[model samples]
Target chain A: MSQIPFTDIVANLPASVPFVGPEQIERERGFTFRAKLGANESPFGPSPKARDAIQTAIEDSWEYPDATSVTLRQAIARHWDINTDNVLVGAGIDELLGNVVRMTVPPGGAVVTSNGAYPTFNYHVHGFGGTLHLVDYRDDHEDLDALAAKAQAVDARLVYLSNPDNPMGTRHTADAVADFRRRLPTDTLLVLDEAYSEFAPEGTNPPVDPSDTNLIRLRTFSKIYGLAALRVGYAIAHADAVTGLNKIRNHFGVNRVAQHAARAALEDQAYIDALKNEIERGKRAYAEIARRHGFTALPSFTNFVTIEVGGVARGDRLLKALQDRRVFIRKPGVPPLDRCIRVTVGPEDQRTIFEQAFAEAVQEVG
Target chain B: MSQIPFTDIVANLPASVPFVGPEQIERERGFTFRAKLGANESPFGPSPKARDAIQTAIEDSWEYPDATSVTLRQAIARHWDINTDNVLVGAGIDELLGNVVRMTVPPGGAVVTSNGAYPTFNYHVHGFGGTLHLVDYRDDHEDLDALAAKAQAVDARLVYLSNPDNPMGTRHTADAVADFRRRLPTDTLLVLDEAYSEFAPEGTNPPVDPSDTNLIRLRTFSKIYGLAALRVGYAIAHADAVTGLNKIRNHFGVNRVAQHAARAALEDQAYIDALKNEIERGKRAYAEIARRHGFTALPSFTNFVTIEVGGVARGDRLLKALQDRRVFIRKPGVPPLDRCIRVTVGPEDQRTIFEQAFAEAVQEVG
Candidate 1:
């Protein structure tokens, strides 16, 4: 063909989104989101120290960020008590996930994930031409044993499991995850995404075992650290996987502001603690709101609540109604999951606003 | 078999850098560069408006940036008189180049570029397992005729041409480039990297044709926009290429702060004009410094000047000498061009510091 040709794999892939940002919805609706409670971002904002670091970084905004990300990685490695050789930082979990798919999954290779799991991981797997083997969530938590079994059956190259999971905002115990890790096929690498680990109850993160070739755990400053807009996330992996990432990843992908902000954010444990409490309060408020609306709010460990509005039609209408009321939120994509709406923890004021909006939205939808 | 294996291409690739960032050199030397005249970053810094935008945006660092990047793309499209569909923003030209390489070139397919041109593009090609065909620069400008020939010879998927070239700091006229664009094989994609275009002489950028399927021109906030640290760059291409990018890109890759900074940077034409003049003055000062040191300063259209230090040994000695004196500058890696050293335009005070350091270093090395 005379025109440029994407690789056949790329050619066959649909133009898809990992997630639809609330900004796009606001623009489409021709109004700003009055209560932004989607995307699981921390409403408490980044640590004051990180914010100050960002402001200070503005003057030096012309210099390229450190490509090797030596200092920041050192900070991250220290925070986890791991060596720098085991750490690799990237733009975010999203970018790192892409690298994971590219590195481990060959064309036509199989991968396993929860059916309603992090769509971004599945998106990346598809982008890399990997055929996904989906195992549905069990009790709103990723079916770990099912994932391992499917990975073994398909000889899947990689299997993804997010702890304190998104959408459902449920969690698995660290001991249970560790046991799950031990049982997964030795050859199939496990991607343990702990993006919400800081907010989960203590011990949600299994002890780091750099020698565990079966695992690579992903972490982020985007959740309790409140630096999602800064886009800094990293993975703790076997040195081989880390080295593989070095070979194919964007070396200078991390921005300068993010490097400094992330380091500062990591240093502030007090901030993470306070935000955890606030998120806990918000989740409780969401559950209360769901009760008032005659719905069930799933128990959540992360900073979001998933409320079932009874069925697909009710959930869809309520989502639309919330949008009409200028309250931006998102719903799970797959059915059963789609029968619920996911709302991120926002400020208490935002909670009240959403509560009132939910009441009116339900009445209007009904 | 027990561990996760990188795909064969990634496994075979070396852990390498497209460019060794100056920060790495400083760490090795155990001292910071006093002049900081490498990396071609703007010493003038981002515009006050952009800086203010960055400061303002820092508070919202918890919320994710727009994945679609609608507003910023709209503003960029309006700036270039193109549709939003015709533009795609990425982390930087470095990233967009990677995307273009992935989209156009299949494994083992051929791509073409100047031998000593942007090494980053070559790194991406190699990362994607695309065999690179190199044509040496003719007269310090990318040999457009030669590049076109090479593209056809290899049935190259993409050919790169950098106008207002880096390292050598030379440029081709817009009309000449337009003609070159017409001559290139229709089947080959021309990656016109105009990173230094704004600082080039008037008529440096010919009008782009969105219908021109053979071309995808890259523009960056890293250069004239003075927002390199923020990592914003956009591509002007046919809608097809842009659509392909969305499928594979890290959707929220562009940090929220960068979007605001780049938009503000683009809107402030007055700031750009002033910086251009400042850069021009700095380039002249470099020429005067080179004259004093018995070197020839090449005519430059970009923010950096390439000074011929007589021969390879002298260039090598001078580069090491300058580094030892806490002045960081770079030299072209290939021979002939290796006889020259590249120095970026810095602040007036920085120029004096570099000038004094250059004189002492030259004497010491001699």
Candidate 2:
């Protein structure tokens, strides 16, 4: 049989996947992890109201979701005190990022991001044949000045920044982010990913200004709201940018149950507060566990902690040992960040499992 | 503030969208439609087991779905008697189409499809800046022979065909589709969308053969399984084609609840059988309604019926009258086909509403 003729770019590209889930790991090893913390999902789960709403809407799965996502968008807009036109709901932030990349970056166009930042955004940029410009992190956080300078230098079409960033679990204050946004060349679109914003400290998120057209802020229900399984996220930007998303976005991408559940989740402020408290507890426990193991845990505003293990090899060994003992954890790919293992904050039971597994893994690695 | 610089190609492209939903129309008109049949959604709803599964999985929504989608893929593979490697699950057939298009047709690459078949597929083609070669429907059905010829003539990277087709509600037999597949150029990837396959006649679907590397068959829960609102679909093909999808597909595209619900839906054969029966009953009722109005109901192997309205102008007038009477239906966009109105099958109450609106619409148009 003759091979199908793919485009030159596609044929030249390797089949590189962004990330493998814990399920695939279990399938290959023929064993399931006792605790899953590798993917940074909230362990507290969704609110009772959100859960109930999903249950009630389950029977209506046969009908296509409202294409406009009216109710969810309305709730989101109300929460932020913005117009509904400023909100664009999607399957998730990942899908929304892909759409944003497609809209701004064509083949051979330059897009900028930190060297070890979210790989999913890089994946989308590469999928569209865009030229990716990488800037190194400064002090375990995204170097905003360097990113902006790089974007201006290359006349990059888009720049991606995740506050309370992943992998290292570090963050920039709201003023720092706002200054970065203001300094960026107007021709460069800034994708300010605030996926972890809900868990950040006071003054972490900049005051909402719908008038700002240069940057698009992305938020998700997957974090503090605990609706990661529902796959709903929204981008808040100027109306034009939001409407531009309509040109390429899957209109009915957000599922009906997700819409209903997200609305319910938005209303349950008490649930979010409780989740924040639980996350704090997990953070403290994780810090103590790290200290006991003679490792340094990075202060995190997000729902995960990154523990520096002294060396890249040690981090890798620790991760493998933890996985062998049925506890899943992940490490960053680039150094000096590679010396750390990232662990998600979860309930006390999960933290207990992690504590026991971490001790064993550290001894085995040593 | 200066506008961000988008790619030249993106700037040149028109901001065209795919189909608008019934909800948008109702919102614009300031009233709900008495009978909602525009988008071809199943009104019978999903199976009780599927609904229950979604309800039960709701609490887990706070966790991100398994990116590998193991359970759903296993179930699909088992159902089709194929290896899990040959199955790729997605948010919907619409998303799968976008991924396939991205993989095969790079910017300015040629893609062939029927002019008015599935607008979403065309939207994806345009989104990727592919050159579209459209073949008009012959005898109210997709002309496979013409499509094959066009693909060969243009050396098209991909060709799209919807079996038990949309818009016209016409279908080609399994033998004919298999023959067409055999005749197509080896390099041309054929996307055989069997979205409505469960509602098709016994011989309408080609035999499942994972060995067939050039043809990708898409099936969805949106039709017979009644999970459109959940947005779950799968593509079946050779391992090579399936693996190619992993390179660009949003790994966590399908929601966790959706996966569970779809798996349960797959297990409930009785529910699907009942839905098929209801669809048949709806088809008969619609046919009778068409006859009473001196229109010819087109033969359909799917859940909807298309009726010839004598002329495009009259069809437009009738459609407006129906809208004015709070009935929602759709018509095709091209010539000859534009003279017909399409209606989806629903429960009896909705059918009665459609019947009353149809009569009023016809009288007003006359």
lDDT of 1 by residue, A221-315 (tens): 88888899989999999888898888888888899999999999999998888878888888888899899878999998888899988998889
Alpha-carbon RMSD of each model: 1.3, 1.8
- The candidate 1 chain B region of ten consecutive residues with least summed lDDT is B1-10
Model 1 spans with C-alpha error above 4 angstroms? none
Q: Candidate 2 lDDT, tens digit per residue, A1-366?
A: 667656666666679888878877888898988998988888778888988888778667788899889988999999989999999999889999998998888788999999988989999998878999999999999998899899889988899999889878888989999998888888788998999988889888889887787788899888888889999999998887876788778776889888999999999999899888889889999999999988999999899999999999999999999999999888999978898999999888989999999998889889
- Which tens-of-lDDT digit does each residue in B1-366 have in candidate 1? 586757888988998878788888988989988888888988789899999999889879998898877888999998988899999999999999998998888889899999888989998999888999999888877788898778878878888889898879998888998988777777888899999999998888888788777789999999888888889999999998888888888888999899999999999999999999999999999999999888899999999999998898988898888889888888898866888999999889999989998999889878
Per-residue CA lDDT of candidate 2, range B55-130, in tens? 6786677778888788999999999999999999999899999889988887789999998889999988887789
If scored against the real structure, what TM-score would every candidate get? 0.98, 0.97
**Chain B only: TM-score of model 2:** 0.98
DockQ versus reference, model 2: 0.71
DockQ (CA atoms), all models = 0.75, 0.71
